[model samples]
Target: MAYVISDDCIACGTCIDECPVGAISEGDKYSINPDMCTECGTCADVCPSEAIHQG
Candidate 1:
């Protein structure tokens, strides 16, 4: 499964730099491109809001 960014996201842009596959997109709450995600969980680990998780 790819990592998902939930509404809990503060859009801090922390996860963007950590995504090895560049799967995260910036916006009001941010979002993960499931098709590009590698499920590495790196973004989840770096997310300060803990918004990123496996889906």
Candidate 2:
């Protein structure tokens, strides 16, 4: 499954740098492109708000 960005996202842009596949997008709350996501879990690891999780 792909990792999802939840409502808890702080829009800190931390996960963007950690996404190897560039699946994350900028917004009030960041989004993850499931199609491009590699489920690497790097984004989740770095999320300050603990927003990223497996979908």
Scored by lDDT, the top model is 2
How many backbone overlaps does candidate 1 show?
0
TM-score of 2: 0.97
- Candidate 2 C-alpha error for residue 18, in Å: 0.8
TM-score of each model, paired residue for residue: 0.95, 0.97
Error of 2 at 32 (Å): 0.4
Please report, in order, the local distance difference test score of every candidate based on alpha carbons: 0.89, 0.93
> Per-residue lDDT of 6-25 in model 1, one digit per residue for the tens?
88999999999988878888
Model 2 spans with C-alpha error above 4 angstroms: none
lDDT of 1 at 16: 91
lDDT score, candidate 2, position 31: 98
Worst 10 residues of 2 by lDDT: 14-23
